[model samples]
Target: MKWQRFFLLGSVGLVSICILLSTVRNLVSINTNCPLSRVDKTTLQPTWPKNRVTSSNLSLNRDNKVHVIIFTRWKYGSTFTGEILNNNPDFTYFFEPIRREVYKNRKIHRGVFYQDLIPMLHNTLKCEFIDKNYTWWDEENKSLDCRYSKKLQNSILCEKSTIEKRDISAYLSKESRSRMVEEICRSVQHVAIKTVRVPDLKHLKSIVTDDSLNVKVIQLVRDPRGVYLSRKVTSDVCDMELSECDELKNNLNYWKDPPFWLKGRYMLLRYEDLADDPIEMVHIIYDFLGLPVPETVKSWLRINILKMSSSSKSAYSWRTKITYKTMVTVQRYCMDLLLMAGYKPVNSEKDLTNLKIPSIRKFSYPLMPNITFGVAKPNTV
Candidate 1:
């Protein structure tokens, strides 16, 4: 009986020791896998490569592909300006590709933030259309249709015959949809994407720093007072205006002290400048892109400029629509942006309507020599 008791006790002790060892191994494994635990708190983080690749340092030619990011906020004439580039046959244009992703993930996904949207742009520039986050369809759970983009219609999946068959009976496969967009993207030599989702230029650090991509950033800004008046009326007008001004402020602060990579890779263009003289702006934009102005683009300008001229929304229509009270409210929220962008503040209704009182102060935008292009008000900067 004593011998049996000893053996039983020994077996029980061995099993307990084994279980304790297994739990400790799992704990160590979990710690090792944790990203925070992997980094040593005492050690400094590694820095990004500081090799500057500005336009001056690197020549843009027809031979080398270029990526252009038209970074601006809503109601800033980005769509109109981007349309100018889209008219060029040599360039493949994406109109607000990140809009859906931003809209879908904003409320539900707490983990996704403003900076997280950069990867979508990066992948688009590289012609990688297969994003796990992107539902392969522009609209979620909608009918498989190519009506969203005329560009996609040119792809195989959305070709007239293919689309007809699918419309009648078959649905577009996920693989086919992705392939369609990818093919269109890869077939082009140059890619341009206009995004209002990226509010801060600093979020583009990863994209600009990448040596593989030849990116040119055009920071398009407009008068905040005008923007407020022109924007689609929303319940939270003041909040929206505040967000837009904050973004402009962030861009200006970034450019004031830009990193080496961004020194010659960025240019600032005012919406007023583009609206007032589009042909000249097109010439400047094409020169910066290192491409000659195609006749197609010239034709597009000639026709569209006339249409815009006839439109009710003249560049300064805000002068008439904005009441003195609204102007004051916008001015109060966006004083810094107005000051930076060279917009004159209006104190009274008379000041608001007086065409003689120019909204934008006279400023020369020298594309080269400086990044801000002399737009920054001296006192504000």
Candidate 2:
């Protein structure tokens, strides 16, 4: 009976040892692979592909996911318009992703700008940032600032201490941050990019032509007079030799002869129109994007744009605030483009200052040769 008891005790100890070993192995496995398990394996490319699959083509079909590009220039109310989509939970928005490169570097040449900037835009939109050319220097780390990108602020990475955080210094390696952002980009229902760097719509032909990317381009334009006034009062973001009128003319000419591919994919939204009726404009914007207007956006408009203080409204009332001399200068340079864009040039100081004398031609559509404003066709809007 003593020998039987000894054998049973020895067997129990052996079973206990096996269980401990199995637990140790499982813990090691979890520690080694848990973080990676969260990452989508398909996007774990050794290097970015020559042509990457856009976010729209990933888990969902192209029809279900849309990529909206807010293409505009400086002082054009791109920031305000971008917030419309940025506030939406469905969109993973990138605010002026190319600003540091374009504005800080001041590289706007057709050849060099297209070669350098377009690829960056494409890689970012497609959620691929692993290329050797995509390195960010110390100064360029401003792109990681949550102040610029509210979506980044909403991420788990952003801490409560500061609005700005450097990915290279504070959080993770560049590649790791890229992987995280790419993961976030892929998981979202839509991707939206607001850029003031794109001077000409024709430059985006490559991105727009990608059938896999359900691309909708909203070209936001403020009256060049308002743009000039804002630029004068505020410090200039960048010193560009090209005037606002020149850029406006360039875009208008491009709109006139937009390639067949651009027909249904493009939209021209006036800043005045949006400022006049934000909710209605948002609905039109949603209609253009083929999306149902989310209640969150309506709530945002109410809190932000609608309930804005009189003092704040006065700040944006450039039409009233700008002096007669300033108005004449802008109107002189931008007159043809202004008339084309449905803005009236004031003849005198009274007309410029008077709220009754309409500066913006209300209900007038932009002079687009092929398409109507706020209408979305099969390919472009």
lDDT of 2 by residue, 1-381 (tens): 999999999999999999999999999766654321111225421111112233422332356687889988877778778888888888888877776676557745656776678877877777776543554322245446577556677675454435654343355666666666777777778898988877677788899888768787888877777677677654332233236677777786656567677665677888777766565566667655767667677667656643333323543477677777666766776777877676777888866667777776665332232343433212211
Candidate 1 residues lying further than 4 Å off, grouped into runs, are: 1-62, 108-112, 130-133, 136-150, 156-170, 232-235, 310-313, 367-381
- Model 1 quality (TM-score): 0.74
Q: Compute the lDDT of residue 328 as modeled in candidate 2.
A: 71
Per-residue alpha-carbon lDDT of model 1 for 77-177, expressed as tens digits?
88888877777777778877777767667785433476677788888888887644556353244433354334554555544444444332135656556
Task: Give the TM-score (vs. native) of candidate 2.
Answer: 0.72
Candidate lDDT scores, in order, read 0.69, 0.66
Collision pairs in model 1: none
Worst-scoring 10-residue span by lDDT in model 1? 44-53
- The TM-scores, one per candidate, come to 0.74, 0.72
